[model samples]
Target: MIWLALILLAPLGAGLAIFASRRAPGALALAGAVVGLVGALGLFAGATGGATVSASLPFLPGFPILLIANPLTATLALLVAGVAAAVLTYALGYMAHDPERVRFFGTMAMFVAAMELLVLAGDWITLLAAWEMIGFASYLLIGFWHRRAGVAGAAMRAFLYTRSADLGLYLAVFVLIGAAGTSEISATLVTTGTPALIAGLLLLVAAMGKSAQVPMQDWLMRAMAGPTPVSALLHSATLVAAGAILMIRAAPMLPPGALLAVGIVGGITTLIAGMMALAERDLKRLLAASTASQYGLMLVALGAGAPVAALLHLIAHAAIKSSLFLGAGIFQHDRDSTALEDLAGAGRARRGIFAGFAVSALALAGLPPMAAWFSKDAILAAALASPAAPWLMPLALLGSLLSGAYMGRALRALWSGTDSQAREPVPFMAAGMGALVAAAVVLGAGFGPLEAMLGAVADPKSWIVPAMGLAVGLGGLALGWSLAPARLLGPLLTPARNGFAIAGGMDALVARPALALAGTCERLEAWLFAAVLSLGRAGLATGEAVRRTDREAIDAAIFALVERIFLMGGRVRRLQSGLIHRELALAVFGIALVIGVLLAAPLYR
Candidate 1:
């Protein structure tokens, strides 16, 4: 419980502290990240193999702010902590020369905290809240270079697009609460069918937005406007992966048709984005597209009812892609360019960075003996077991081929020339890349342990599947290498380059109109408020008139009666004189007068 709280709060606390301080925010951020890293490892050790520890807060009634360390959460939490630690370590060197190190470090800390909470959340409300917080953090990080219009625009675009999908998640929560009377994941999963199906579908839409699926994917490409570490964090282990995790968590409740739909979308995104990566001239853009394509592949595994396979691919992709991005960043920092053409002889100059890049790229292409190769094959095998196996297998293979083709293109650009003047990479950055590369190797070598972990949840038929996947991955890579660049299919390249234009079009058409409609509603609300105020003023005037009329009538009558009573009392007092006989006569006369007045006033009249 203490470790979990530290993991969630360390970043947030550090962020606040850094912002409050006037100097060395980066140092403060790094220190906080170190603490978080330790806490994460502690939590992992304390709750290995799905052990859970929970505590309730006294303040939040009924909610408790629970944190569970199930296998899934544990795995994701480790990933978040690991990446954040690596990135923060890298930032120690990367931001040393930057002017806005304070803002950068502070925002990074906040982002880490949000991501940790997202993985730790046990209920849908907590998950959604953390999800939005991460989105907020991304918005700040993406636009870190606020001086650049493109960076700011990209950040806004990402925020708007994801928020639109978040609405679907919100609706899903409502549906679940209405149908199951609880937002707890366990409860919702237990109440499957009908409304649950609808909830699943809505959740898929939210996943699509976050994962950078066809219609909501363009923001990722534009997101390259941010700094490289931001890119690595967003593309590799954090933002895009969150959507896949959400779907995986809800797998038990998802309908077959909905799952199939998820598979179909994933398959299409993989194919399209892979093609785009092949045509991309910018190295970072290529990587961005590749991230989308890879995420789509993971989604395919999830949709095919193979959560373990999806998780395997996710872990492999995270490690390899982080290294690749860091390598790309090193190149860009040296050359001040992300264009692939500008990096003609980068490989010979930066041998270590290029070597790291190549290893990761091969892993991404699912080459043999690499972590991705085994994991990807497992997904294909899972798909084969599904009813849509025939179609899914072909699509997965095609995506693999495209991934190989683009990766080959990148490799050729990096290694083909022999320029000696290319710059060397920073030590800390290389260390970060090296760490991820080592992780990839370890994951690949220890496939047995990973397989065992996954097998506990599902079957482990490893031999044939791994062999076939390796063969296909290697075959694709060889085919891509042997073929001449000019002979590559042109029309397919165009579609890939454009990423089906789905993400861009959706942004311009759907998201823009929705934002416009929101603006219109704001105007309408202002008009309504004015109208209500005018009506209120008119009602107040009418109320004042009614009050005045009542006051005039009631007060005038009371004053008139008081004057008459005073005159009558004076006439009665005049009868009560000085002498005793006179006083007796006056009293008798007063009594007679009162009797006469009472008789004459009513009965006589």
Candidate 2:
């Protein structure tokens, strides 16, 4: 538990330190990452050693924010830490020449810390808090170089898209916690029937946005406007990974109805995104598309009731994808552009970097002995064995086929250029890429132990499963290397590349409608303001009438009475000025008048 806190705090504290002191920001960031990496390993070791680590801090009344070290949480935490360390290490070299390294490193650390909080969260309360944290942190990181035109807009697009989808997460958590009577995530798995199904579908909606599945996939490509390390971390195990991780963690609670829905969504996303990868022009955007496609495959695995397989692929893909992005970053640095035409022959310019890049690319293509090869096979086998095999299997194979094709296309484009200018190697950048590439190459065989640790043993559908996957991958590679992606995809290329839009996706469907809704709301607010102003004017008019009534009618009547009183007083004063004899005479006259009146009254009666 302490280790988990360290894992969460190390990056966060380091980020704050960088922002506060702005001194040796790189060294501070590196130290924090290393400490965080060590702390994550410690939690992993402690979990496997049966340490029973758990902590509950007061968060909500009767709903504590829980953080615990179980096989699942610990393993996920390790994946996050590993990827963060690698990405940050590379960023040190990548941003070495920048003046705002302090700000950059600070935001980067904050981003990592947010993910750690997410991965280690034990209850819905903690998860949701961490979830928002990661979203906010990603926004800052994505727009870190905000001076660049369109870069800040890209960040805002991502934030808005995900923020809108995050409503689903809140709703799902509300359902689960209400039904289960607890915020504990594992406890909520006991919630069955309609509520569980409802929660699962809602969770899938959130995952789709975060993972960049289908309709939500557009933002991931646009996100390339951010710094390269941000891209690497975002795609690997932080922002993009959050969606798949959520689904994986919630897998046990999903019902058949929801599961089938998940399968369909995943299948559609993989096909759409894989084709987009094949058609992408920008290297980073291409990799971004590939990330979505790969995660689609993970969703396919989870939907097929194989979260373990999904997780394996996720871990392998983290190392593989981040390494690939780092290589692209180096290529971009050398060529000053990530456009395929500009990046042509970039591999030859930095042979060592390309070597690592090729290894990861081959791994990403599902080549033998690479981490993704094993993970991909597991997914294929799981799909073949599942009830939805008929629907999922074809999609899985198609996704795999396209994965290889796009990867091969990238390789061929990079290696085929005629220019052969060479430059001295960047040892710092190379070291980071090398570590991840090595992991990508060897992490496959390591999955057996990981599976055992989690007790999620693999059950391939005979030896033929892996063989079939390998054949499909190789065939895609051949097709990609020999033919243009447009020719290979034929008619489907344009739509898929354009993100499967109906006349243009987000612009036509989502953005315009959202803006229209906002406009309507604005008009409504304006009318409301005018109505309020009209009411105020009417009240003022009424008050003015009341004031006039008091001043003209009431004041006139009072003044007239006052004038009469003054005249009467003047008469009395004149009487008082007379002698006492006059006063006596007046009193006698008054008494005589009273007696006369009494006598007249009697006569009248």
Candidate 3:
């Protein structure tokens, strides 16, 4: 458990050192990787000696983050640590001239450390937390060159797809936990029936999005826009591998229905992605498509009831594919492009690197003595022996054949071009690629023992299996070498080149809907703005009307009444007499008028 903590923290600390300090980031990154690598090896040693270690720290009231050392987690930890160390080492050479080593290596370290936590997670809560961390780290690493055009978009697309699928993971974890009353991954394996089925299928959805399976696969090829080390890391053992890892971990609890669903999805994705690879013209994009296809094969293995087979392939592919990508990075450095046309004869120029690349390619094609050949045969054996052999076997074979075809095409193209383009070898880069190529060459023989460690046995007596795999692999290579892709792919040629768009790809699913929503929002915003302006105008008019009414009505009436009062006062002043004679005459007139009125009143009565 202490080792696990160190393994997870080493890269994390290195990442902080890279970002937070002004010193040389390469050394810091390398140190972190070395520490993590040593810790993983120690964990592996402990596991082999029949020791298990687990640690739990409080997270929720009852649910906690669980980290454990077991055969599966330890092996994966070693692989992730080793690959991350190698990629970071290679990046030391690759990014020597680039100015952003701090940012690049920092994110790389963070990404690697996150993967360690993911692999060593003993409970769903830890897994879910680590799952999100990986997505964030990948986003940062993939968009490390944010100044580059289209890079931000590529990063966003990758993030959106995976983040959306992450919903399934959230749902699945709670589902299993609800059913089993525990968040511990090992304990949740006891969850069966409908609950398991629902969780398993939900988990598959998450896997598909992360692994670049089918419709979600479009983002992966575009992810090639990132730096090559990013490509190598993302494809090899970190982000893309997470989905398949989840599937393998949860394989025990999946119901047959969910398994069949996973298998069928895998089979379909393998064929289609292979077609895309065969049609790809960019070296990195070709590798990206192949990554999707390879994971598809792993899914098929899981579908065929062989998680061990899938695990073996996963390990083998981590080495082989990273080597291939590293070699491509060297080519990209040489030609300043990954396009097939630009890379023509790149192999001829960099013979040593090309040799390593070719070895890994052959290994990917499942040739004998190579890592994938051993793993691929195990997957084939699993598929062929499964009850669903009719679908599984053929899909696996088609994927295998296509793998050779595209790889052979790449090799021939590289070897045929001029050697005018030469690149100076970077020792660190060479060392990194060399390590992986060696793994690609020798890891095949280790799978049987890996299975033994896990107590799973594989079929060994199927002689026909190896013979068929070799023939198909060699045959695909021959055809690809001799033929043009235009002829080989035929109708698939155009569609695959256009990214196999379904109903106009993003134009239909994303762009059009997004545009419509934007337009609606714009119109709504405009209307609201207009309505606000009209209200302001109305208020001004109302205030003016009130002012005018006060002046014209109330003020005018008061002033007119004041004028009448003044006129009445003047008339009364004129009627007033100031002489004594005027007062006597008025009194006599009043007496006469009173006598006349009294007589008239008596007659009326």
Candidate ranking under lDDT, highest first, comes to 3, 2, 1
Q: What lDDT does each candidate get?
A: 0.81, 0.89, 0.90
RMSD values for the candidates in order, in angstroms, are 8.6, 6.0, 6.1
Can you write out model 3's per-residue Cα lDDT over 1-605, one digit (the tens) per residue?
A: 67887899999999898888847888898899999999999999998866888998889988988998889989999999999989888988998888887888888888888899999999998998899999998888788888899999788778877877789999999899999898999999888999999999999989998999987788898888889989998999999999999999999999889988898889888999999999999999999999999999999999999999999999999999999999999988888999988888989988988899999999998898898998888889999998889999999999999989999988988888678555676899999889989998998888877888887975664788888788878987887788888999999899998878888764466545656787899999999999999999999999989988988989888988999999999888765768788778878999999999988997977
Q: What lDDT tens digits, residue by residue, belong to model 2 across residues 1-605? A: 67977898999999999999999898888788889999999998977765657888897788998987888889898998888888888988999999999988998888888888888888998999999999998998888889999998788778877887899999999999999999999899888999999999999999998999978889898899988999999999999999999999999999988888888788888989999999988899999999999999999999899999999999999999999999999999998999998898998878888889988988988989889889999999988988999999999999999888998899888998876787766777888888899989888887898888887866746778889889988988888888898798899988877778776676555556666888899999999999999999999999999999999999999999999999999988998866899999999999999999998997887
| Candidate 1, superposed: residue stretches over 4 Å from native | 58-61, 422-425, 445-447, 450-464, 482-486, 502-504, 514-605
Q: Where does candidate 2 stray beyond 4 Å?
A: 516-605
| Deviation from native of the Cα of residue 595 in model 3, angstroms | 40
Candidate 2 scores a C-alpha RMSD against the true structure in Å of 6.0
